[model samples]
Target: MNAWNEKYLQVSLLWFAESARNKADPSVVTKDDQEAYLRQARFAQGFIREEEPDPPMARTYSYQQPHALPKVQRAFDRTYATRGTQREPAAEPFATATQSKHMDHGQPTQTTSPLAPQGRSSGQIQVTGQWDKTPIKLSFDPDASGEAFYQTFFQWAVKRKRGADLDRERTTLWLKASKATPDTQAYDLELKEDELEELWNTAVEWIQENKNTKAPHLYATVEMEAG
Candidate 1:
């Protein structure tokens, strides 16, 4: 089997075995069971692979201009110095517009939905999101694969923050797409794990067919888990 299929099978079998063991003896684990679990864990480890750093092409694609990083870093430092904390939020860092009516009025007004009236847009989708109470927006090619969509989103998010590079592993990210209307339930989804490609595709399909007149707003949050 391919790497993806092999890893999936390994994880599935591991979980099934664990479940059966728990059901057989919820209160206690015999030494044999412990050894059995370790063996299963070792079996699963064969399918695992370590993550690699972003490639040179990825850096170029995401940053667009390498020289711009220095400027952004200087600005980030100034903001952090003034705030006396590294967690100072970026001021609409990913937004295409410096200021909008939404910022002026302290209320969210539709800045221009990227969705084509009849169906999916021919161009990139302008996704709007709020992070740390700061409004941000970014564009994505709807035609891209779901994995590409997820990666670009995270890369953009990390670039917009002050100290994201330092503690990225400790961080957990998630998205909550706004409700179609006041009466509808919102779409809440997690990131930083498996099944993300499916989730992203589902989100795109939802946006395309949603009943709302405009594209729904997206809210993103990043949390650092305690060590």
Candidate 2:
């Protein structure tokens, strides 16, 4: 059997039996049960991680900071009552007019944007979740088998169109794979929970649209667990 078929068989059997046996065990988890329920799932994400706040600043200024000598008699006169301070004489009348001609307020400021990755991402697919499968190479897509084909549909989600709070609800992604495929290289992608949900939603949307024309075996929506 092809690698895809073998994995499909194993995943199906596992979710059917093993999951039921572990319903009471929090360690034995399930997610997207309404869609693709499994002991584990794998995917990658694209989001900026939150950073910790900076430490509070120390008191910098000192009362005697400007004094160079230790014994400082007040040489300077304090005119606080008079509020004594000399102001600059009014600028020559010509100063404002001469500088006004060069006012560059309307001109656009040039800015440089950092360059994006020049080489295209040869990244195959973001996921290659596996199950107990035979080691035989497949006649079709000998390298990636079928996982990449499904994963490509989900990878289309850009950052943020993916809803928030999706990750906390999802299961932990396992990098381990049962078979080696061309797309296997991307399987190790360390995707957070949010990214996985984005991909899952995108793939399901694609499957929903192409159900009749292409792969009919795939369907939309998560499978509600039989309670």
Candidate 3:
């Protein structure tokens, strides 16, 4: 069998054996039963090859070192001699215009400015943008595997709409997938608030269009909030 099939079989058998042990009756520890379990375990170990040994170690050294500086003290004296001191009168101011012609025209000019109260807090509007994802499950045909489905959907839905608004330097997208059963798959898309609504609507349309074989299930709810 292939590596994936082998791994799946091994894990499944291990889980089955563990469940059997947990649910086994207290009175059923017969010699025959013990022998059968041991034989199965041996067969599993023999079927799975041991991993290859790691490579030889390489020589390494720490080159960091500290140094101390020498302290020195020296004294030199010079004598200052002054001949005389003189005072001069200040210059008179020139009669020039103070106003300039250039002014910003893009924004509206304010005639009356709001007065601030003494010892009062500044009333500035601070915008705190946030986004979150509800638990969403989307199903696709078996042919559409890996992360391609979610990646494609996101590129068209969330990324396209909010690509400009997103702080590419700080933005991130998270996806969670689950294969609860061999035939069923679920995917959850997590994104920021500015793109959440667009993502939701686009996802609904995408699932409806792409999933033709079997009617896929989709459930979305806010999981957590991020700023």
Best by lDDT: 1
In order, what is each prediction's RMSD in angstroms?
49.8, 57.3, 52.3
- Single out the weakest 10-residue window by summed lDDT for candidate 1: 49-58
**Which of 1 and 3 is ahead in TM-score?**
1
Clashing pairs in 3: 131-193, 133-223, 134-221, 134-222, 135-221
Q: Between the candidate structures 1 and 2, which one is better when assessed by TM-score?
A: 1
Which number leads on TM-score? Answer: 1
> What's the number of clashes in each of the models?
0, 9, 5
- Off-target runs (Cα >4 Å) in candidate 3 are 1-139, 158-160, 163-216, 222-224
What is the C-alpha local distance difference test score of candidate 2?
0.36
lDDT for each residue of candidate 2 in 140-207, tens digit (9 for 90 to 100):
11134234432432332222233232232332322223223233322222234455444654544443
CA-lDDT, candidates in order: 0.57, 0.36, 0.41
Q: Per-residue CA lDDT of candidate 1, range 100-133, in tens?
A: 4237575656667676576445455656655665
Per-model TM-score versus the true fold: 0.34, 0.15, 0.17
- Deviation in angstroms for 38 in model 3? 99
- lDDT by residue for model 3 (147-221), tens: 444344445335436434444224443321212222233334444444544465555445444332332233322
